[model samples]
Target: MKEITSTMAGTVLNILVNVGQDVSIGQEVIILESMKMEIPVESQISGKVRGIKMKIGDFVNEGDVLIVLE
Candidate 1:
């Protein structure tokens, strides 16, 4: 299994993948808003999305797991 984590503290602006969806390495999985800037979170490994740890509008910190994959 693999985890997709937030790169910085921010509010989740969008979730780009759903559970059971296949994802590739470097694929944009989530968008975060911080300091009025939109930052994209990408998957570090290719796999099927197993879970989403946060939803839109949720606040997340740097290093927090946002998505789980297997």
Candidate 2:
């Protein structure tokens, strides 16, 4: 399994994929709101989404795990 992690501290603005969804590398998975700016989190591997670790409006810190792919 591969872990998708946040690159910076932010609030989870949106989740674009659900569990069991197939995703490719570089695809947008989630959107983050930090410092009054929006940033997108991308999928790091091409695989089926196994787990979603956070929810919308959840606060995420840098290096926090967001998703799992298998």
Candidate 3:
């Protein structure tokens, strides 16, 4: 199993992948907006997305789990 986590504190701007979707390493899974800048969170491991931990417009902290994969 693998997890995609937020790299910094921010509001969720977008979710690029859906549950049951395949993802590759370095693929953007979520976009977060902080300080007017958009930061894309990428998957470090390739796998099928199993879950999404947050929704658009939700605040997330660094290291928060964004997507679960297996």
Backbone N/Cα/C clashes per model: 0, 0, 0
RMSD to native, candidate 1: 0.6
* Residue ranges of candidate 1 with Cα displaced over 4 Å: none
- Cα lDDT tens digits, model 1, 5-68, are 8899999999999999999998999999999999999888999999999899999999999999
Which stretches in model 3 have alpha-carbon errors above 4 Å? Answer: none
Candidate 3's error at 38, in angstroms?
0.8
Higher-lDDT candidate among 2 and 3?
2
- The model with the greatest TM-score is 1
Each model's C-alpha lDDT? 0.94, 0.95, 0.93
Per-model TM against the reference: 0.97, 0.96, 0.96
The true-versus-predicted C-alpha distance at residue 35 of model 2, in Å, is: 1.0
Model 1 weakest 10-residue run by lDDT? 40-49
Candidate 2: regions farther than 4 A off = none
**Ranking under lDDT, best-scoring first?**
2, 1, 3
Error of 1 at 39 (Å): 0.4
* TM-score ranking of the models: 1, 3, 2
Models, CA RMSD each: 0.6, 0.6, 0.6
Clashing pairs in 3: none
